[model samples]
Target: MKINIPNPMFKIRAAAAILKAAVIPSNLRFPGRALVFLDMVRAATSEMAADVGNGTKSDVLMTPVTWLQDAIIEAPIVALDPEGDPIEGSELIALLETPNPFYSLEVLLAGTTLSLAIDGNAYWIVNHGRGGEKLPAEILYAPHMNMEPEWPANDPKKFITHYEYATKGQPQLIRPFGIDADDENAGVPGNVEKGLSVIHFRKGIDPDNIRKGLSPLKGLLREIWTDDAAASFTAALLKNSGVPGVVISPTDSEVNMTPEEGDAAKAKIETQFGGTNRGKPIVMLGPTKVEQFGFSPAQMDLSALRNVSEERVTAALHIHAAVVGFGAGLQSSKVGATMESMVRQSWYSGVIPLQKIIAGEVTRTLAPALGAASAEFDNKGVQALRENEDLKAARIGRLYRDGVLTRADARSALNFETVDADNVYLSNLATTFIPQGQAAPPPSNGNGADPKGILARLQDPAESLTNLLKAHGFASPAAMLAQLGLVDPGEV
Candidate 1:
């Protein structure tokens, strides 16, 4: 054999090809597929922009979203200690009070909530102090549409290496928490060394792309489109004097015209009868007849269709139609739903859960950076989140009377501060306590009573018997009393 050896350059080329295949994702390997994927992303982004734009214009979409945003903004941000209790007068609270120079905490919270509702993602840029300070100096809100996460080459375990923030100028590269400005693996070339990090708050995971969040509006896109189309149709009808369309033709079939004549007739009819000329009384000759085409507003039943679409949209956003004062929700209110109950339901199902997610994310990311154990949105100040005071007081009173909770615990449950006397359990004057295995005292006799002449006490015969049995050996007097039916079991 002539010692046929493979060329070194060929071996190098083969190894390079294998390495490239392994390192680059398959979608990126083919230029056509990559372009297709890019187009898909562009389409998705356009859809998201349209959803948010249209949502802002439509009351059906914006009502619930604004309600939620207002609720979130009204709540205060609290820093927590290691024991999960709110830390009083912490630096974290001070920083949060004025998160940045341009906006207040409320504006930040409102923007974040609105973004989560619209884009399903919110981003915050944390600018750490230049003098080696652990806490951030300023927190800047980044629009979700402009922020994107980047990952290293084919690294599944390292899902995100850094965040790429697109600006009007050059795009800024922000490292995640733990990566310093000087870190070798901070990100791609031209990564800024300004010690910036990003905090991403996503509504939930996207099944299609685990790296991204799925917008709540995704499923309701068709419904939104339908609502918009219906609105446009209704507006058009109103503009046309409540008429959908009209057909202008000769009443007699014998009155056929040339194509040029037909075009001229159509132009003349539009000039005099369209838009502002609607219902101006068309002047026709030669037995011409005008017939209305398309469905009228009544025939379309636009109200019912819009109401249904509104209900679906509100439901997807975790808000009842009644809470948003939509027709469908108002109809339900006529049946049984109350505004208060609907508001509470919205808080429980929509606002609180969203607050928890945002708070939990803050606790995980911003709190530790600021040397705090946790950070949470305090809804205690929000009236909508509060329980009915009357019902709460009654429940607490019942629990206190039963000796299940101390005065301090009950007060705490009601969001009241405790006093020194609050450590004791509440004692009911009506309750007569008997020691274990001891007999209850007999009812007082009227003989030799005090000069005040207090009435003699009388005890239920069943109670006396039950007390006697308890003194002897019976385990539960309440059970025995229930069987006898002499005393109310609840009272016992």
Candidate 2:
């Protein structure tokens, strides 16, 4: 029998060939279709009074997305050095504060978070100076819908060769960071000059295409459609003054009308008694009967169905319905501490994880471009991320009082600077003055000059301890007894 092992390089080349030949899925090819579908669903649902919409804000998706964006931007981006310490007066911080003349850090974060929520991907183009500087001059947001990645045909080690940015004008080609633009086989389509590198932040992974991300909304399409239909039904009912669909016909069998006359009568009835004319009276030449044909809103249990749909939508997006103010969550929620807990839950489950992804991408791409070691969001300033001050203070105080923590440690836990005087543990007053391995002094016999007079003064612990030490030829304060070898430090 012969034993044989396959070559690792051969396997790598085979895998690369398979990947290069793999066809991109429709979801990755046209991400804008999903967004358009979401917009349509929102429009259909906006007719209901409970669906929040005003002017440009009509999408129910905006509720959670806006909440997440606001929470993420609350923590400012901080630049870090090689030793993992936050750097002060950094150029990266200045660039982030004013990413470009047109937008601030808040706007940049808002746009990025919005794109990630809708399309599961967000991109930023870092534009360098004309003088070939390493630091970026300006950073511009590129909408995920308009961007497409191009892969190399022959290179097994490379993933994305370049990115194609399609706009109203000519399509621009952008080079990836660390890739030379002058490379002959850059895999760009045209002879156009390529733009700067793009930093991408994505949420969930897409199994169909490794280069693209799958939107969370992809799995909730049915839920959104059901909710939209429910809203449309409610709106239709309200349009008719909460009346169900009805059928109108003559009761008398002998009084038959022509087809044209029936059509005319139907048109007249709708024109006079439908929509804005809902409250108008109906009159007929002959005896007529009207019968409702469909189920009423209460009979269909539409409210419960809509509530379920709302919950599924918020849950799939990693947000609590209570945090989004949906009626479904509000019905079961309380006002004070419960609401605060829900907000904190939303920050932990939704906002913080997304912020980590954005921060990691920035550390990998934007920080290096700006000559920094790494980047992170400074969440210490965020109110939701911070522990309750009252609770934290009580915990530190208890630890200090119990001698589990030194005074300096307690102060440091509360974010205060360390003081040298606070470095020692506090002595327990109950056990500090108790004598150990020593006999009590003899009582005085009414003599003014007796050495035992120090024993009579033992009523006051501090005074007696000091006098006793002085009577033994050591003149020191009771507080300083710990410094001397006469008494154990534990007792003092």
Candidate 3:
């Protein structure tokens, strides 16, 4: 019998094919089937983010999602070098500033965040570098509807290793992949038979459900829709319902008409006074008494009801209504400041976590390729951290002068990377003085000028006069006068 040998390449391709066949038609399971339940959010017939892209279904109709998108994209991100310092003027920053031909860094991040917020997953397909290395040259975001994750039920702790990109008319390809545990680089998009170089950022993780991420506003979307319906109903009621007024009622002395005559008279009456003319003056015949019913729109508090709905939608999106110049707080400057503070808090609490996630993914995946130690997306300007830079510097300076902190410590505290501290100096007099048993302190020049002639230029007469006493070895003009026991002619 001829010996049959197994080819390694054939085995790998065969395994990949088998995996792809198993995963392609398989239906993934979610924890709450929340997306399905959220179908009624946009309307009774409208699709949810699960079917379309996140926030896309309601984007044209809802102000909250659009306003949130604006806020999310308003901030720029900083790229960090391996030494935990910002990499200014780097190619990576350029790439991030313009992730692709169609979108800027802010736009890309905003889209990613919207995806995370709506669908609970963001797919980022990274194009390879010119050298065929797995570095990302361009990143394209894929909607959750376009991506199909193959999560094996047997393994709960494991991440998805196989996915199918189901684009219209594109050939279906199966891929094998795994996240780099040590480096935590999960974004690698390619044929699994070769390797995965694409990143899938999944939020709201749990052991029970690996494929689906928990969306925080899933239920709130439905509630918002409900509130919208209520507001609409209230509006329609006010618009269509005539103000409380009455049609004239006939007294018992009047004779009843035949059914046909009564229907004719009813139609005639409604034609004259049913809708628009309900509140208008009526020219009544003798003893045609009038009575009214129902309350006015103001009495029903329609405006307050609408305002409550707006407030709820704003809160769910983690944004202030006043930020968009809409709410009651928009008119006053004090309220405007409150809105600004709210924005800062929202950025720190919501956007910062999302930023950290993106930064972590970028650092782990791109650092090695970029030859940097690590990378990060900075949010200093977005969070208004730069405004306090002067205050932080002052605090760090005080601590350093007190000898309780070092130059490196001060730098670290002020968010700067460490550097050589050998040449660093403290200007505190306490630190400058010699110890009690050591040599005496150096004599002062009786002026604030540098002893090493650093400021010896004396740019003007004012500068020269300021240094005159120091150059003459007098502590002050007053001290010299006291020694002489008399004032100078100028002083007199």
Candidate 4:
């Protein structure tokens, strides 16, 4: 029985081995001259390294070395030959196993690639990266941010206008979200759909974008977080954010009616780590007198929020963890279509998906990260070439003539298959992907990148493969696309 994974979006095609034979360091000799640039990637020394790629970054909470490397050491492995170090491969195998945990991901660009000689002979492969790790300066956003059912409103999600601090007159006035004043009767706005709630800068010098600023995570956000509506100022002055800085109290968690033990926890904060960074961040959240700032937990449809929260968190952490090598290599090299799924995960990192980040396709952002010294690659000065029509055409033509493509060369290139006028090369692949492309790669079709082309190919994998190589000007888009099918086609 064919399981047509709804949307056919779950295909996992990377397993065919996108990785080519290793480029051993010894074979490619370094020039006599020496050049050194900035030293951003220090040797792995931080205790953070031990727990990185795993959720338990905190030593206090980490129970095991769960990253992909350690996990592989435990997986079953076999020796290929005496030269490749059959026994040694088992030890190095640690680098090949583990589960990916990225909720976000970034690549290692402009850095030294790690290599290992295989079979004690001349074979080699990139085992790890040693530098160039940069997360986008701006946080990648998911299509929608999940909220607790208790969140401010219950309608369609709304966007922000601007974040304002203490406004003219009164205790405070938030422009688009909400406002808060010294008077308790100022009134709190209920959660309204297509609207917002505000967090008044009641204290002073607020620095966050109430809209985008994420706090230092105290270990991935707790699945259940409630902002009590009735909570009052005096109660806060008395106690503080409870251990984990929170009590499971829901509506009672608000500022108004003061739950019995609730106030006790606030007082407890003062009693223990009173008045210091060690104490809570000492922040207050409430309805903006106007629905201009953020959202009010008061109006949320708790049921929907609860469901959304769980689903959103799961989607988010999975994607987020994938992008930044979260559980990559720490577990497995995103086996087969999993890498496809991993790439798709980036779109779920926040409330709005990045225009540049999407699933079932490759994006320009995937371009091989240029090394710090890319300026000198001297590959016909292509690197120095400016972006324009001529450059695009030339590059596309070059790749087409040379038959080089990004679907990654297959371990076994097909033979004698009388290439039809519409000769396709790779059918195993599913793409709109070709990292460095221009005016005429097989997929280019003189129309530049078709981000959604793969979805179109989804209907008939066979026919699409036949017509693929003719895409753009690539010598064989078919081979490129076909190769993408290395892994199973239904799991990505």
Residues 156-226, model 3: lDDT tens digits: 33346556777789734433222431222222234442323456676666343556565556545554555
Clash totals for all candidate models: 0, 0, 12, 106
User: TM-score, each model?
Assistant: 0.66, 0.67, 0.56, 0.17
For residues 1-492, write the lDDT of model 2, one tens digit per residue. Answer: 001112323433443444333322222232221233344545444444244322114335667788888888888888776666667898888898999989898999998888887778888888876643356778888888788766654544445667888988998877765455655544434453444777778786776556777777666655666776777777776786465677888899998889999899889988998879988887777799988776666765687887877788788778889888888899878777788888888887888777877876776556655656667777777787677889999999999877889878999999899745667676553332327988655444432355444446676565666566565554566446553323455554
Q: Model 3, which residues run further than 4 Å from truth?
A: 1-67, 86-91, 127-137, 145-148, 152-158, 164-198, 218-222, 242-282, 285-295, 302-337, 366-373, 383-492
For each candidate, the alpha-carbon lDDT, in order, equals 0.69, 0.69, 0.55, 0.27
Model 2, backbone clash pairs (residues 3+ apart or across chains), number: 0
Task: TM-score for candidate 4, please give it.
Answer: 0.17
Error of 3 at 265 (Å): 6.0
Segments in model 2 whose C-alpha atoms lie over 4 Å from true places: 1-60, 83-85, 129-134, 183-192, 236-242, 245-295, 408-424, 427-477, 480-492
Displacement of residue 85 (Cα, Å) in model 4 is 56
User: lDDT per residue, candidate 4, 273-373, as tens digits?
Assistant: 56554635543344312113322334423443343333433343233333334332225544745654443333223211211111111111111111110
- Cα displacement (Å) at residue 312, model 1: 2.7
Candidate 3 all-Cα RMSD: 13.7
Model 4 bad stretches (over 4 Å): 1-170, 174-314, 317-320, 325-492
Question: What value of lDDT does candidate 1 attain over all alpha carbons?
Answer: 0.69
lDDT of 4: 0.27
